[model samples]
Target: MSKFKKDGKKNTPAVSTASLPDIVFMLLFFFMVTTVMREVDLKIKLSQPDATEIEKLEDRSLVDYVYIGEPTNTALYGTLPKIQLDDAFATVEDIQDYVIEKRADRPEAVHGAIIVSLKVDEETKMGIVTDVKQELREVQALKISYSTREKVNKKKF
Candidate 1:
């Protein structure tokens, strides 16, 4: 008959899982702290039209932004280059030539692809928008996008 004694005898297996929660929490905190967030800055004040469908811009590499606004009537405005709307309208040919030059300069990643993001003021007339679109079309820039803000609380199905 063998006698069982409680002296210098171990019955449980030894495995170290004590620090697992701490390690997991540390990794989670590291990822949360190092994450990068994308932010879009508005160059002009405009009341964006609401839309039920949201179209995400897929190609980020081949994109250029244009800001259109009237010059302010103040001393500070004098320091900035005055954008003569009349003259700007006449420079349609020059603008098209510049776009072609810029398109050639773009890297292969965005080669043969160009997207223009037009930011216009809320008070901007439809005729101006049409004119800008036509100019872009003449440059053979078929991929055009109008800037607009997304509405909050969009219902998802």
Candidate 2:
């Protein structure tokens, strides 16, 4: 005689996944909101100079960026300080047209409020920068700022 009887039917457990979709969607939204998508892909390496005093831009929307550095893409561009406007490598002559197009993208009221920030490598010569400045001046886009890292002070014990 058997002490226990065998069950005719096995119980099928149901896993609850009703909230899985919500959790996945929440994670997706979180990443979407927190992530910052870079507008330009830099082909150069830039080491920003250190500064004793640095001022932060008040409004980011009213600012445009220009990058100058030695090209990291050695095969395409040689190892010299080159200008980058948005995603492409550009020349001094492109500055005026670039500024005009960028300025035109903004509202008319904010045209005067736009600031052009230059992120130039410390090793770069001033000649290229001077040319960029002249181009900006020609376009009447005189508001300019040099991007630099804040100096870190170390005290002797």
Candidate 3:
């Protein structure tokens, strides 16, 4: 006796495309709220050195990145100081202090392991690299790594 049933036509299921946006927005909001934003506190300029031997990193969780570069010398004869990771920290203590403080607050943050990924210019001297490594060693940074880019041009040839 219903108006829809009297005609003998099947009742069509209600399709919803309207709720799609709401669902998507809810997911977006969830991700936005729950995701941790990594803070990049240092702006470093570095030119990667070329290397024939490349090694894959087995452990990445213990790594921290540091960049080294020579400051611009306006005078042609001016002596340029070799800038390294520790030197950078001396200039800007905020990032290093934050990490150290965080480690103190959470003992598991560092977990008795430290690795520094050093990014340096190709023109940087070996002595400079050694000095940087030594400085980090003094700070009890047990692990050190040099960052390098893989050569891709060989594949084209």
Judged by whole-model lDDT over C-alpha atoms, candidate 3 comes out at: 0.59
Candidate 3 total steric clashes: 0
Q: What tens digits encode model 2's per-residue C-alpha lDDT throughout 1-157?
A: 4446555575656898999999999999999999967858987798999987789999989999999999998778988789999989998889989999999999899999999999999999999999899899999999999999998876647
Let me know the TM-score candidate 1 reaches against the reference structure. 0.53
- On TM-score, the candidate that comes out on top is 2
Question: Which candidate number maximizes lDDT?
Answer: 2
For model 1, residues 1-157, the per-residue Cα lDDT tens digits are 2466554676667788999999999999998999744334433344556554667677765776555544444354442222122123223345566567768878856755688776555566666567667877897877877777776775578
User: What TM-scores do the predictions have?
Assistant: 0.53, 0.75, 0.49
Considering summed lDDT, which 10 consecutive residues are worst modelled in model 1? 81-90
The runs of at least 3 residues in candidate 3 whose Cα sits more than 4 Å from the true structure, single-residue gaps closed, are: 1-44, 56-61, 72-106, 153-157
Model 2 ranges off by over 4 Å: 1-36, 155-157
- Residue 80 deviation, candidate 3, in Å? 2.3
Better of 2 and 3 by lDDT: 2
